[model samples]
Target: MGFWSTLFGGGSPQEKAARIAAKAEARAQREAEELAEKAAKTDGLFERALGKDPENCSYDARQKAAIKLVLANETAKGREAWLSISRDYPNELAHALEQVGVCYHLEKNYRAALENYEAAIRVGADAGHLADNMAEARKGMAAIG
Candidate 1:
């Protein structure tokens, strides 16, 4: 076999292709397994943060747990958690809406981010605090358009 052939596994064209394909499949499998493990770990952390009785937890505790998920880069999950909190705790609706807006912002859904941010302000979030974030969302929207 030539140097190239030997270096590339010393096989016929079809054999080399098969070897490459097998290697790619194995790599994909490994990646999938790693992702699954990571998801499990994240879920465990989320569950622990929420405690055994999430429904009985205070709004502050629930909000902290949701914020943890966002800090961990689980934006979608964090958004969902915040939305749930908003529904379950009317007193804290503005803050929860603001957090959901933040998650949408992180995900680059500028329109949704703006909508949520506005909703938060209307519901009682400090407009001064949310102004920068709303500006950023507007910038993102302008860029995409």
Candidate 2:
């Protein structure tokens, strides 16, 4: 079962919160394990992807591996890589920016996330998701400010 399933399974109020925290811990452990696995393979596939034309060559697979690098590599490298994908591939820019937005949100930088999401919308991103994310971000911004 997924984290949400484990957390929200039938329970009393206190039991529910405990389950949620435990589920979060388990998910963190799983993510850490996956990050470790990706780090082991990064030296090869990650380097091979660098300086390569991702257009016809398929950036989809390459981009995913690069995303994993954010956890292992310094912030500059990950931001640089993401920026490259976004700039060089206008066709893929929206998604790339969306990914960056997610990275910022993960880091608790809501303003940056909203900015990136707005950029994605301006670039004709998946409209449905953009709208929903925009609403959520606005709610967050309102709450904080």
Candidate 3:
């Protein structure tokens, strides 16, 4: 019935395996819940995801929050978060700008999207695939006209 029983008792190996699996699943669930709770404690959604002390949160922390918000379809919020962080972390501006462009593009603000993508490239987010994203924004702008 318990770990001691599973380990020391004469239970079948299958039962022991199942118990171990259930315990592992429970532990994973508990850890996930704890992380979610920690992310929920801040004021706004972005802040909450970042933590209560965003000012002290690292660049990676802010980046993770932004990415999570975007993936969750809170793109506008994610863009805002990225923009806010970029001001303080100019070195990360290129990546943040690219994300902002993506948000604007999704919202059909094609011109803003194109501008941001261009800015991202200019600021050294100049990876080859970034060009593809910029081209998509350009296509969107053209389609609008």
Candidate 4:
């Protein structure tokens, strides 16, 4: 119908297949680049998070490692790292619990998310943010049920 379509043989099955394949390849290339970029950043973050040695990791390093794991989508590891020192640092504990809840929510584990949020509240995290997160987790759980 259009001049460009006519010139490009828009009705041709072979042309459509070629275009689709090319699009898919382009998408794959973009995804690969994105993944590589994410890996590079995560690697740097992990290195910083493990400063000195494994046996003598600092509190700051542990905190950073928890954050890094969350960023890298290693939710379980991140959650554990956060929980490990949560009691020692109430503020951080609250923050960590809230973040872990968010990660669980993203993974569609609404029960875990709700549990984390509740723990955050119990640990006296920022009341405002924790309350909001708890409400959201509850909503997510309800939606699933």
Candidate 5:
């Protein structure tokens, strides 16, 4: 009966299910390709901003690159860049700590986020600017607990 129905131009139930599954597979493949392309573009931009030797790059250039990476949703790379800055330029430690906290917050690691935020405050980052971020991390921690 299903074969006869299919021959008559009405797809059988199995055929309809297969068609839906094929469409879903195709959509998933396209989405994966798009994500890969986006990641490649972000890497290119990060390299351009930071240059080949990021360690030797000017502080401003490294900071710009780190900011770009973070804004592009590459939080781990951004955090590393910020850490390098803090290590090489002690004067910028407070700001770098705060940015690292933000990256941790974005990653949903609330405990790490809070710790970095506190360290930033201790290092003289403006408390007023960090207050909102600290509160949000605390809220997230509370929700989890």
Candidate 6:
């Protein structure tokens, strides 16, 4: 049933449809305002899940921001996150070493990209994806320059 028909249909025929419409409109307005308020909230104040372990968490505000940035596909922000965490976390450092290659690749810096990719491998990244990435960077270096 239509919204108005559900609430106002059962009412007396004398019930003005205008009043029901006004009430619905007011309710919609209130809900919209509530959504807007929630959207305005700053996520900077919250810590999300831990990557390695749920109990292992990021207490650093910058790291938290970087996570949000990575989630949001902000590559520059992702790079910043890598920069901040690589210094502290060995795993993150290895990952960041790979990301350095990625950043260089994005900028078309083939030599730099290859160097970082190799460094990531040297740093103990044996992941198949890393191998594939290194190969791709090598191909790019050969083709582009």
TM-score of each: 0.70, 0.54, 0.62, 0.56, 0.69, 0.48
- Model 1 regions more than 4 Å off: 1-34, 45-56
Give the alpha-carbon lDDT of every model.
Answer: 0.85, 0.70, 0.79, 0.73, 0.86, 0.64
**86 in model 1: Cα distance from truth in Å?**
1.3
Candidate 3 local lDDT, residue 95: 86
Position 103, candidate 1: lDDT: 94
Please identify model 2 stretches exceeding 4 Å from their true place. Answer: 1-57, 70-77
Scanning candidate 6 in windows of ten residues, the lowest lDDT window is: 42-51
Show how many residue pairs clash in every candidate, following the order shown.
0, 0, 0, 0, 0, 0
Q: Candidate 6 lDDT, tens digit per residue, 100-143?
A: 67766666677877788888878886667677777777888788
Compose the digit string of candidate 3's lDDT tens values, residues 39-108: 5642355883344455747887777877778777777887888888888788989988999998888888
- Comparison by TM-score, 1 against 3, better one: 1
lDDT tens per residue, model 4, 1-145: 7999878768679878998999999999999999999878766555444442465367777677768778778776566666665655555777778877877876889889888888877877666766666687788779889
Best candidate according to lDDT: 5
For 49-140, candidate 5 gives per-residue lDDT tens digits of 44445464788877887888899889998888888788878999999999999999999999999999999999999999999999999999
lDDT of 1 by residue, 87-109 (tens): 77788899988998999999999
Model 1 RMSD in angstroms: 3.9
As a whole number from 0 to 100, the lDDT of residue 38 in candidate 1 is 85
Score candidate 3 by lDDT. 0.79
lDDT of 2 by residue, 1-145 (tens): 6787677676578988997899999999999999888666665445533436345235765576557666665344555567777666668888878877767666666788889998888888876887777677777778889
Q: Model 4: residues >4 Å from true position, as ranges?
A: 1-33, 50-81, 84-91
Better of 3 and 4 by TM-score: 3
Enumerate residue pairs that collide in model 6.
none
Candidate 5 structure lDDT? 0.86
